[model samples]
Target: MSIKLYDLAGIDDRRFSSNCWRTRFALLHKGLPHITVPKLFTSIHKISGDNHRTLPIITDGKTTISDSWAIVNYLEAAYPHKPSLFDKQDSLKSYSEFLQHWSLKAISFPLLQIIIKDIYDRLDPIDKPYFRATREKRFGKTLEDIVKNSEDNVEQFRSGLNPLRVSLKHRNFLSGKKPLYPDYIIAAALMWPRSMSPKQILHEDDTLNTWFKTMLSLYEGIGSKQPKEWVGI
Candidate 1:
């Protein structure tokens, strides 16, 4: 049976959230057949009624799982033949899970705000006001305020990367040679950064740049093309 993965289609594009892309990539990497349900931010109300949350929900005919991490976990268990995302060893698996959670909660939010601000700014003038208003209603703050707050976290967030850098030096993947849950977590968290980060930051380290290129190449192979309409300065 094919899994039904519901993603915010346009939002899942590189211009949007990396979390969305991670889930999509996981599906592709596992060679799992799934249906893509493209959701729009404007349709949050409808999605909430069905998902009881928001975007990136997945259903396996019998069960519905929301949240990107949860969807990934469900997939790993439901389809374990491809490879295990968590390690077979107990200690490393635990550490990998910890890193994944930390990356998503501590790192992804601020990064997402920074990335989305750029995309938000490029919306058609006629559409901008409504988009901003809806986001404010949903998030309880204007986009500018969110971006400003996110900026405050940048230095501290960068500081927190030392451990990750160390870990990356030792292993090609966050958990091992093959992509794992934490690998997806870090990749998703970096999605926005990869697209909108300053050239200096991107080129600061050869290893990091190579990793980013690898991710982009992987996505490209799976029909994860970004739409031209969404591209903006």
Candidate 2:
């Protein structure tokens, strides 16, 4: 049976849906055979042809899964003979959850502020008005207003990544020398700007940048090197 991912895409296929990227990272880590079907941000509903709405939706044979963490859990359970993600699933499950939580709070929160416009500018035209208006409503401010001080905010965002930096001081990846769920959670989040914007998101001298380069090189450049139309690759 074949696998297809209703992956999120922007104006071009050089898309950066961080959550979706998490799922892709997991699948590629497990060495699964799959293909991605790009879905514009506002058009994700078409993936299910029902009330279901979200990208990075995957189907293999008769199974369908949404949410990156759940998809990874499914992949590990179903493909036990393949490479492991959590390593010892039962022992590391909660630890992975902790990493996910940390990524959401520490990385996703501030990173979203820094990259909101980059994301908006990359959205398909059909997704623009809705993306802008809905985001404005949810954020209670204009996109321009939201990102006005992003350059200043970037420093603070980098500060909050202290844990990752301190941890990386001794190891090549979050999981010692080998990349794992924790590594993917944080590294894939950085792909937000890597996919769309040319502004250097990571500080040039930060160790995080070095770690991220390694993350990009993983799985034959599948994580960072997507097909690009906006920036030079």
Candidate 3:
């Protein structure tokens, strides 16, 4: 049986959850057969009836896993015969964890100020109230207020990627020459903004922009399936 990925969705079936994207890429990377079951923000509990507050949950037979990191480990262990998401080196796994947290803090969090409103605007009507309520409580501010002057912070967001930019200066991907779980972690972070907003978060001439294009073309152009709006190349 194919794994069931209960992925988060938005208005018009947009799958914008970065955590879910990480699992999607990991599944694709391992050549695993799975199907996505889109869940609205307010309907994630319907997936497992466990009061699940988050998504990117996968059910592989009797095994149900939540959170992208745990799901990756589950996939790695359960399907050891498939392509490896990580090397045997323990340090690589630690580094992948670092990238995951870094992307969340540096990339995804900053992006919320810019794209949170867009995300709210794109939600299904049934999900809007819950989204607004939960997010307002999380940020302790109204979405409009959080997004106010968001444009002014775009440069700041871009500047925060300096460490990543320097790291990529010497390699084609974060995982040396080939894409790996670490690559998926950062790619998924960018994918969140790509799906939520119609704005280009990266500078036109940045190498990250070029690298992202390559990512869009990978795995039979999976990332390109989403409509893109970049500054320029």
lDDT of candidate 3 over 1-233, digit per residue (tens): 99999988887788888999999999999999999999997888877787566988998999888999999999989888998888655788899998888888899889998889988888899999998999999999999999898888898999999988897999999888898888888888888888778767987688888788788788998987874434332
lDDT of 1 by residue, 80-196 (tens): 787666644567667756876777676776555655566565444544576788777877877777767655566566666667677778777666677766676676666555444
Off by over 4 Å in 3: 227-233
lDDT of each: 0.62, 0.81, 0.86
**Whole-model lDDT, model 1:** 0.62
Q: State the TM-score for model 1.
A: 0.74
Model 2 ranges with Cα > 4 A deviation:
227-233
Error of model 1, residue 227, in angstroms: 5.2
Best by lDDT: 3
Give the candidate order by descending TM-score: 3, 2, 1
Considering TM-score, which of the candidate structures 1 and 3 is the better prediction for this target? 3
